[model samples]
Target: MVREKNPNVLSVHSIIHRQALTAKTLPTKLTTQVFNLLAYLLDICYSLNLLNLNLQDGGSNTIYHRDAITTYTYKFQLWNRKIIACNYSCFPKLFGMLEEALIKQTDTTNKISNQLQHLTDEIKRYFPSLCYNDSYRLAMDPFTLTQMFYRKHCKTIAVIKTKYRSKFNIASGLRSALSSTQPRIENLCKNVQAHPSH
Candidate 1:
């Protein structure tokens, strides 16, 4: 009816909604397994949403985003280990659902362990840059580089300090160059008068 009223209107279905519809076709014997899987997935989704929100903060730059991604990658590893060990402390909703349903820890762990490991692997694969500990450390904390330089050679530290000081001086110089100020028109006129006319 809405399409009839507006011929140009677009209709779209969510991928998640489609997945839910597909899940309903599973056998009745697997109902508990299905619910357990859904609960575990929902917990993961919540955790991912928190990371998304953290990245969405307007003031954060690439360094912070990389830090967040690195942290989330580590979390995936931790979650994989916990799930393999049948420890549900990180997944409160999944734990509660399993408790309420009287489901065995072994069942949930067996079901989720491979999938969680695959997810952890995928995360590490997707973010190859996270392997460079030195770059992340330098970007997140300049002092780390300074300390390393100081340890390596005192001259290197002095050079780095000079470079940083020059950067600040350039920024301040640009600011003063752009600042609005009244020109000395009278002094200019007097100087023009004092000069011999050609």
Candidate 2:
């Protein structure tokens, strides 16, 4: 009874055990709260397929649904922040989780963007503006997120930028290319492994 009641009877790995306990006690509110909204926004945008020239009044319609974004943001504000810091020094850990959430959300957005052309058979617009808000959130860092990404990839990302990048000739380029060739590739590529085929 004394051994069971005593607080001092701890093993050598007490810190690790305590952290795991705390993490499980509190929840990781990253995906359901934040990243899922980003994914749904990307999906709606792909489905809408807004064209620049389609708007005659210099006004544009959004592919993204705003109410969902607002609702999720409200929920995050209401509950996403860590409820149990557990210790005086655990604030950094709480911040680290937030930073993880923001960074991972941006990564998920990029993956969805990369797959946009295939989704709902829509045109893929590699617009910088598409992911601007997410980029802004992730660019400001709490530092350990780089380590997290490295762990995810199991290697460092090698970004070797070229001095002279090829400018996209969009006017008679991607639309024409897609219209002319993309269908053939989709149709004839059965029993084949490569995509964007032919």
Best by lDDT: 1
Which regions of candidate 2 deviate over 4 angstroms?
1-104, 120-198
RMSD of every candidate to native, in Å, equals 16.8, 24.9
Q: What C-alpha lDDT values do all the predictions have?
A: 0.77, 0.39
Question: In model 2, where is the ten-residue run with the lowest total lDDT?
Answer: 155-164
Clashing pairs in 1: none
Candidate 2, residues 1-198, lDDT tens digits: the string is: 656899677556588888887767554454333445454454345424432224333443343323233333343233222222211111243334445455334443343334432432322232323334633334544355566555654422222112113543333443343343545665666858666666
The lowest-lDDT stretch of 10 consecutive residues in candidate 1 is: 169-178
Error of 2 at 55 (Å): 20
The parts of candidate 1 lying over 4 Å away from their true place are 1-29, 105-107, 131-135, 154-198
lDDT of candidate 1 over 77-119, digit per residue (tens): 7887888777787889889987787757576687687777777
TM-score of 1: 0.59
TM-score of each: 0.59, 0.17
